[model samples]
Target chain A: MSTHARPRIGEQHCQECLVSIGPERIREEFPTLWTKVHGKPLVYLDNAATTQKPRSVIEALTRYYTEENSNVHRGVHLLSQVATQAYESGRTKVRQFVNAAHDREIIFTRGTTEGINLVAQTYGRRALRAGDEVLISAMEHHSNIVPWQMICEEKGAALKVIPMNDAGELLLEEYRRLLTDRTKLVAVTHVSNALGTVNPIQDVIALAHGRGIPVLVDGAQAVSHMPVDVRELDCDFYAFSGHKLFGPTGIGILYGKAYLLEAMPPYQGGGDMISAVTFEKTIYNTLPYKFEAGTPHIAGVIGLAAAIEYVERVGRNQIAAYEADLLAYGTEILTAVPGLRLIGTARDKAGVLSFVLDGIHAHDVGTILDLEGVAVRAGHHCAMPVMKRFGLPATARASLAFYNTRADLDALAKGLHKVREVFA
Target chain B: MSDLRELYQQVILDHYKRPRNFKKLDGATRQAEGNNPLCGDQITVYLHMDGDLIRDISFEGAGCAISQSAASLMTTVLKGKTKAEAGALFEKFHEMVTGGENAVDPMELGKLAVFCGVKEFPVRVKCASLPWHTMRAALEGQNGSVSTE
Candidate 1:
């Protein structure tokens, strides 16, 4: 309700300080020289999709490829041994990052899509029976929804969706009503990608557990934006991508309770997944590696470890606070535009702001913003069910991260004005 | 204003505000529903055919300006054309959208030429071509349901 405060202009400080952040300092501190060379000051607000790589993550990637490049978990050569140590150490770091109960529970995956598919193929194939139900929310991204659909189709399991209210908050009463004896698993996003609604995941998990239903929290959107401790939440399974969390692509983390992970079938079959293989007989390895069959993304895993370390140094609490403030700032400035409608207004929300201007198509808005050197995602955001629920075709989404500033929102505001002028 | 004018030509906005042949054809002989699931754009193309000629054409749907206007323009152009001619027009329009050379002159396309700018926006080309694709499907005797999910 406070009047929009003008952000401090042209300040420089260490990554620790709030008051001394400047463009030049950020460019010098981060490895964004390639972006800077293009004669554009990029204002990236699509963090819900993926975060920009910092200098440390890029350097770590380079260091792994140049200095420690070798196949891991095999051979007695020194390079192979160092690579194996770094890769395994990266696994330990991931376990700590999400506070998984054991390192054995952290299975390296090819980002969130593969992580969920691994669960669906392994656990869903074994545990789910015909007439049993997998309850997912209406706000799930395509990655979360389609995998469950495939599993349900194969197993004759019914997929039930938990609906949301107009404010983009999940209808708790409806969810409770939908949870019957047939409910086998409840897979939900920790944060809604389209609506920015930070779901009450702890309560959701507790309720499902009370009913003897396991829950998988898709932390693809939540992990980077907030502090996530899987042990405290007591979720049976959690999945998130490294790219979304400022790490390299082709790497993700799937956290499951050690017992459940050990019980599930191997997702893929190849070299590292087996203790020994013969023409007639084969023995499977232990947890984590049972699901990870092929040679993993070693450099990507090391880079993810570096990214997690960077996040810890910055502190999740500080990052969350900064992002929250930016979200509020962005929301105020954006909603001030005449005839501008903010689509998602959940009481508990993340930094995503999906909205529509009365007379402008979201694509047009996105195109104009791109020309102005501001990037935001526009469309159903892979959550077509959410758009259908609100009777909207598409909405422009400006999702923030720790790196975004109030000036970015100001540029967005200016861009919206241009949209209005063009449409008018 | 002039730069924005390039993207949204006056004719395009005019068709969007008051689309031609923008009505349902009850008991229509050929009908198809086209959907761009990415944006939730839906259009139902209705054609009342007399032998091989499209005696009447109309559409009813909800979508962004580009899609709605494209549908309106498609209906207007195909209303009196034969099924074969309409199919050829569809091919030409498809080529124009996907950046292939087409024989249809820009000026001859009338208000439909307003979509020429859509070629530049690779993402929105789907929006501008949804109705034409649906109409082609209907003329080919396919059921009235197609979705770009």
Candidate 2:
């Protein structure tokens, strides 16, 4: 096991504390944001889908291939050792990023989907029995819902849902009622990708803990928006994708508690997971390496560490404050549009502004918005149940990041006006 | 906004707002449902056949302006055509929207020519072609539904 790390520099000495970083400076960091679409300046509002990578992160990926390109954890050569230290440094960064208990608790996987699937197949398959239930909220992304369903079906266990209100906020009362003795696990999202509702996961964990049930948080949408202390949340398993955090794709972290990960079996069989291999028998490796099989995404891990460093330098609190204001301004501008109804109106929300305009399909709105060089997501958003709850097939979602300015929102409003004009 | 104007022509917008035959057919001889899961678009084509000819054609579904308008225009043109004629027309329409080589003349398509703009927007080709696929399925006695994955 390696050392559990802290942020590279203390928060008090951070540059954001001394001087406020405006959106203009932040925008310059992301090269893609400067490009034009359809002969118009791009207004990227699809942060929920995936964020634009900063120059630092892009450079990090390129640097790894150009400078230190070697397989990790196996080589005794100098280049291999350098690459191994960098890869392990990435793990330590992720450990500190989520504020997990140990470096070994952070297992790098493909993305959030794989992270949840790991827990579902290993922990869920082990704990669940013939009559057991795996409780999840209605607002969960398909990644969180499907894995448990697969495990439940195989184990002859039932999959249950905790209902939510029209506001897109989960019903704590219903959740309490549903948390029965037979529920083996509780999985929920920290922030809804489609709805943007910031669930009270602290209280959710407490409620589940009251009944001695462990909670797993789908933090894919939360990690970039706000400060996520897995220790503070007391969640047993926390999963998130690096791409959504402005990192490289195909890399993500699953931070499981030391005890829980130690008890759970390896999800996949291959090279790194085993301590010794023979025809007769084999012993599994330590905590995280036990779960990580095959050649891991070393470059992705290095890129993810660079992304973490970039975000930390920008300051999480500043990002949260900036985006909160953007969300409020966006809500005000969109609500004023006639025949437009906001889908997720949770009092506590983050990043997303999902809506539907009357007499215009979401695809049409997305098309019109694209014509104006404003990018957004217009589909089920992989949250079909949430769409059904709102009685909509799809919604046009404009998700915000710290780099977005009020001018971007103005462009969105202008594009929406164009949609109305065209449809009218 | 020249491209936008060509894509969302007044005819398409009008049909989208007040689609013709946007209801379930009562005495339809054959029907098939089509779904574009990417955009959550669903369409059901209902055909009333009289021996070899399609006596009536209708569609009931919800989708983008291109899809709904394309279906509405399809119902109007194929009213009394034979299944073979409709199939040929569908092929021409498909070629027009996909910008195929040796594309059918726009004048030959008449009101259906409005969908020519769909060629510029490749992602929406499925939307324009979904109802036609469903209509083909209905004519061929395909059971259950079709998905434009």
Indicate which candidate wins on TM-score: 2
Model 1 chain A lowest lDDT segment of ten: A6-15
Model 1 error, position A129 (Å): 2.6
Per-residue lDDT over A1-424 for candidate 1, one digit per residue giving the tens place of the 0 to 100 score: 1122532212111245332343344434354433631245777778887888877788888888899899998879999999999999999999999988799999999999999999999999998899999999989999999999999999999999999989999998899999999999999999999999999999999999999899999999998888899999999999999999889999999999998888898988898999999999879999878888989999999999988886776567777887788888888998899989999899988989999988677877887777666789989898888888998889999998777778889988988897776667
Q: Relative to the unseen true structure, what is the C-alpha lDDT of residue B99 in candidate 2, on a scale of 0 to 100?
A: 94
Q: What are the per-residue Cα lDDT tens digits for candidate 2 across A1-424?
A: 1122433222334665412655776777799999999999899999999999987788888888998999988999988999999999999999998898799999999999999999999999889999999999999999999999899999999999999999999999999999999988999999999999999999999999999999999999999999999999999999999999999999999999999999999999999899998999999999889999999999999999989988888888878888888899999999999899999999999999999999899999999899999999999999998888888889999999888988999999989999999987
Native interface contact recovery, all models: 0.46, 0.86
Off by over 4 Å in 2: A1-13, A17-19
iRMSD of prediction 2: 0.6
With a 3 Å backbone cut-off (N, CA, C), the pairs that clash in candidate 1 are A12-A20, A13-A20
Q: Per-residue alpha-carbon lDDT of model 2 for B44-143, expressed as tens digits?
A: 9999999989998889998788888989999989999999999999999999999999778988888899998999999999999999999999999999
Alpha carbon deviation, residue A359, candidate 1 (Å)? 3.8
